[model samples]
Target: MNGDWLIRGRDGRLSVYQLSGDAVLCRSERGRGGAWTAPRTVGGEQKLHPVLGIGQGIDGYAHLVSWRPMTNGESGLVHSAHFRPHLGALDWNPVGHPRGQGRRTGAPAVAVDAQGRAHVFVPGEDGTVSLLAQKEKGGWEPWRELKGSSVQDCLAAATGESGRVELYATVPDGILHWRQQEPGAQPVLQEALQTQVRPGTLYALATSADSTTVFYTDVSGDLCAWRPGDEPAVVVASAGPGPVSAVRCDIDGHDCTLLAQRSASGRVAFAAYPTELESAGAWWTESGPQLSLDATVSLTTDDNGRVVAATSSPSTGQLLLTARKDEPGLALEAWRQV
Candidate 1:
């Protein structure tokens, strides 16, 4: 794989490991990106939960979100840090705790618009969704509720040439809800549907490249996909015993592709649905390398079709970061670093 992606994970102990990378270099106590620098403690005294978000800002810098358990059992507090573009260092300017909102925490969600500003989505204690956007002057804007009711989960998608952002969240009641914010305009809900996706409930949400389709799962453990244009929801994969996480990638604009992994095993699997051509059926047979890794895994991608996947192995206590590219023969096995 020519394109390699990576992540840095800390287990709340004193050690921080740079995920698999091509650089093959390690330094002492590094945080905020560096060959090695001192790791900055952001999540306070508690163990930093992995339910955070990491992505590139419009300015081409890496940004991070780390949350900690708060006073209320239902709500958690979050913090933000921006890494200088391509500089192995993190900028700690707008740092602090989420305020003015009742204690609320769920899966942390993030999105960066055409501008470099970052937007973070958290479920509020009131059962409504809230948002936090970065300010030019340095400081987090007050939390703004984006939607009402508890969100099942959130997956962000950047759409159009302007790079407008849309956050897709599934409601506990089984409705897939979405909201889009274009720089200066007000954030509004797009649509909601009963969408009998899965019975077990949604564990994650991922969008296609164009932000047109939304893929989700139900409590019954089935994988289903729904888009604005598609009339009825389609089940892409049936349920397994435990929870399953899905990541959608645009193999090509002419087709739709998905990669899903089980929570317990950390084994990754793939599914494809073609639009330009007629396939065997609506859902293609599941295929691809079955990854057997030690750590629980999370997946992300870059613009160049490169994937960044992280696995924190409970067995070895090591966080493994791997990158795979959808090349001609098979997913290229390019090892960047470990």
Candidate 2:
């Protein structure tokens, strides 16, 4: 759908919201979400894959990935959705299934390159990670399994300037590994020893505009940074929540922004970590305006770092999208809208 949607408790009660030319309308089950205006139906009776994406492409179109549900009644499979704004209205269509190679596919990460092609990564059931590339001719190249250790948590990154694509994942060995695919170099596995990022903790990994520096959250609840040429990782900020919900590195220079889900308070907050003094181990910092979220949140940052989209429980609060405008080394200007 052209609008936003939220899914609750898995009773198959999916809520679809449509931003009409006028106002935002929501549609869901009569008993589930109460009687509301019948918004346009987006997905059919099929269950949503548990993830969604909406963003502009290099060709000015919109690329989306509504992850598909698992076949074994678990969690696997991802459905690709594309929206092409040709004349007046948006034409929405499905692209491909974001699956690896084996009998398992879940936790799909998607990114669009400068060529408008989609690059997706889905960790397999065997702990191996795979990559899928979609060409402009509407065909998918053979699934390519990356040469890395078994990764449990995996995410995708794409550089707008270099068209460089990378996959970041946490291996079972508690090591953070990444695979960078570029024009000349083969897919190589590089470890980040500086961050001390271990397993069992949520780590948000991002890269800078130059595609050399790596940013992520460490187990100590601090924003840590590392460069491809650096020997050790350095702490950028210690005030970040120990349980970060979402993190985006490489925002507005080499800064990293994180959306932390405070479990004790169940509130979502934002913080920024900018490393200016590379050798002196100094980094700029900023705090968000604060979002007192009543429900649990699942967070993700957009490519531009201007907005952070989060899904919350209905009984707690309405779904919201926080637009945060960063002022370099100053506090962030944040506004919440449903």
Candidate 3:
């Protein structure tokens, strides 16, 4: 799993795309860190919100969904990349057959159910949630609308026991929305079981067959979690007043979600939460480096050990992508610019 971390961003200085990931191209290895090559611009002046999903093919095709900024007046897109046989050059092809153009909210959420099919949920025009699913044979289905205007900022997903993709989002009215998807069948949509909570962004992690752990920004701008059958508990006080991201990871034998957030002063921080019920919060490592908005942190394609965090510098407006490999029984290292 040793390879260079791919940094995909629009460099305002050069006004081009700096794409690097394939081993044969510029990557060293997964565990090591290094400098990136001088990227030759290939696109226009725009921002990209991309999520990577690994496939089940022999080559394990990596699927990417790039959600364009709403101000750019562009629609969401889909792309696929894979290494050729014998470690040949990388192949990044556009396989997007989109449905329509609309405003996109936060970064798109991706989840592969138990059936090995990838489901991409994107928030678009009027806070509508659209889905672009991969077919069984070898292609992508046209973009299909899922739900109407909601918050358009929060979308979290995980797969259930039957491999059904479950999505959670919060609307403007302080309602937490939940839905479960099965192919060819209508999604069962409903409001989450109410606790003493209000409007906020959410990140849901499937911990066990009967439980799901949620970390989110509460009404008072603090980071909190709602465990199974338990009241809402504080994870990080004064956490938000900004955006938050989380990814479920195992520490020792317990399930945990690593939550990251940008503070009001621009400093970023993270904390881990146990999957099962607990009254106490784990020790958080918040004295970390600074980060900007519209940043992203996600588990690498196929739920691999790699964790990638990409952010933009507020002052310089530079996009930075960094990564750390998460091995079981170990912790992630400090963030480094790729």
TM-score of each: 0.65, 0.61, 0.63
Best by TM-score: 1
Rank candidates by lDDT, best first: 3, 2, 1
TM-score: model 2 vs. ground truth: 0.61
lDDT of each: 0.45, 0.45, 0.48
TM-score of model number 3? 0.63
Worst lDDT run of 10 residues, candidate 2, spans: 1-10
Best-first order by TM-score: 1, 3, 2
**What is candidate 2's lDDT per residue for 86-124, written digit by digit as tens?**
112222334444353223354556655666676666666
Off by over 4 Å in 2: 1-45, 52-56, 59-62, 66-76, 82-104, 174-186, 191-209, 212-214, 236-264, 273-317, 321-337
> Largest lDDT belongs to which candidate?
3
Residue 117 of model 1, lDDT score: 68
Q: Of the candidates numbered 1 and 2, which has the greater TM-score value?
A: 1
Whose TM-score is higher: candidate 1's or candidate 3's?
Answer: 1
Report how far residue 174 has shifted in candidate 2, in Å: 4.5
> Which portions of model 1 show Cα errors greater than 4 Å?
1-50, 69-76, 84-104, 136-138, 150-162, 197-210, 238-256, 263-266, 275-294, 298-310, 320-327, 331-337
